[model samples]
Target: MLFVPLPFVNALLLALVFVFLKKSNGATATRAFLMLIALCCLQSIVLGLRWGYNVDALRFVQPLLAALLPPLAYESFRGLVDQAAPGRFRLAAAPLAALVILGLMLAAPILLDSALVLLFLAYAVALARIAWRGPDGLGLARLDEAAAAHRALWLAAFCLCLSALFDLVILFDFERSGGSHAAILVSNANIVSLLLIGLAARTAGHAQTETNTEPEPAPQTATSEDAEIVARVDALMTAQHLHRDDTLNLSRLARRAGLPARQLSQAINRVCDMNVSRYVNDFRIKDVCTLLRQDGITVTEAMYRAGFSTKSNFNREFLRVTGMTPDQWRKAESRDLEQKDRMAR
Candidate 1:
């Protein structure tokens, strides 16, 4: 009996919801979510192609797509933490390049098989890097709780690595394997990977909602020194436009503000009622609005100048903050500007 797991169907549904949430949120998250979805879609296509076509070329393409998935996902999560915009063409580069390379490699089965195996190995290494390093300056402390977003990613990474290992084993021992055993292992691994990814999507969605729902902590009394530090950081963010710096990280921001990174993070969290990423994103969002209103700059250029690395992220964050997409925001800004022009006339 050919059986597909029910969890996969549930995962697909949840992934769709994540896509909607990401699209609503507008920038890096959206791009990340889209990359995630694309990976899943390609994975599904590869499965169908393998069985239906029984082509070595399709087999070669599957692992390449699989290799590209984790890096794109990590990049997406990085965007979420920073709310930094992403480059459009740059975002497309990995998957596009992977496809092009895989297409070329298909001319020779021996070469294609070896290349595909190497790609999966590299993918495993990349996933390990992300898992080990964590995000931004945020630590594994956040993932201590079972419900944390990082836990889902950790689980997903584990599943992907395991799947890749099994794939390598199958490839190396293809001639020795019986059909039933190979089919069972492949099916089971696919189901496990799908389940983990679904959990990750759910976790991300829940984390976003939880963050929004949590009440702001009450303001506490600050010593004069603390107050001064807060004021300086805020002023630099607002007046000096320090957040516009792509290289502007907590350590640099702290150095610029003449404070320790820990103290700066505490000050921003306690005094400003936000994290560093949110703080920087607030400025980027403001710049996006200003550019939309001005009418001279293209949206892509605005996103770039505003320090966004991807359109999906920019769009997601813009919509989340302002309740409108960049296009919608631009149209509304243009209308207002036109109305003002009429009044001046």
Candidate 2:
């Protein structure tokens, strides 16, 4: 039997995930997410070769690949919130900096290791800043999927920070243990980080399908009344049934209302006292309630017709809005109708 390295298995699993995402998402997978996953797979393979197989030559290549991961993960997530974010050239500086560090490592090997730790920590902070805005901050993600995307951003940030910690642990082990425990620590810890980053990339990939080609309008900074903004959005939702589009996002809504995404979100937040996703789901739940009261419609049908994509979300939102499950609400509504019929008779 051939001895298969654990890191090699990790790489193959990531490869499978990459293929699964490609097949499932097709063009909907953003280039950044695809690149992020591909790099993870490559890094895992390099880890396998260098540490598992004891190939000393790959030491030079591994850190350079590590340099690319954080920026790509950050870019993958930043696109969810900011449509007008800086281009890839700006992020390319990380890998270029890594290249220079790689050269410096010949004289001071710790240079590359220390830089990788700091690079991961920096991008982790960047990712956490975006996630700190909550689901509404992901203005470009579909309203139905923003929560999931937000969670993914958080996990990605945590994974980066954890990766940095793992590097630090490996550095400590080298100093204290003559690098005795380095292989186990690297194989177990780093592989898990790679898997988590891949999963986060996959979770956030769904937002890529809701692409908008229209250039985002400049945000309006005028002191327009919040009531006026709410009225405009309400009128738009009523007249155009914008809430019926599950792909509706804050950016698109802001674009339609002739307001900036942040400004619109702030208006909704202040006026409705709820996040934009919750506010929009209120409209959807209202429509679902109306449909549930009518005959010839199933709960699933009502959920889909009212712009809900998943039963779990639909049921959760329904409960939040109505204080009852869909079934309970329908039964209670039926009893009210029966009582009305009896009184009329």
**Per-model C-alpha lDDT, please?**
0.57, 0.82
For every model shown, the clashing-pair count is: 20, 0
CA shift at 149, candidate 2, in angstroms? 1.0
- Name the regions of candidate 2 deviating beyond 4 angstroms: 85-89, 209-224
Residues 158-246, candidate 2: write the lDDT tens digits. Answer: 99999999999999998999899998998778999999999888778765544332223223343458779988999988788888898
Query: Evaluated with TM-score, which candidate comes out highest?
Result: 2
Show where candidate 1 strays beyond 4 Å. Answer: 1-29, 45-49, 52-61, 83-93, 100-104, 111-114, 131-147, 178-180, 205-263, 266-345
| Candidate 1 residue lDDT tens string, 1-345 | 765444345446655755665665444524465556557655755655464344556656665766576556556444324333557854775677577557756566555545545554555565555555333233211211112454555666676666667766666666576444554455445655654665565454333311111112224655666667788877887887775665345555666788765676666666666665666677888987777666478898888787665565567678878898888887887788789999999
Supply the global lDDT for candidate 1.
0.57
Could you tell me how far off, in angstroms, the CA of residue 130 lies in candidate 2 after the best superposition?
1.6
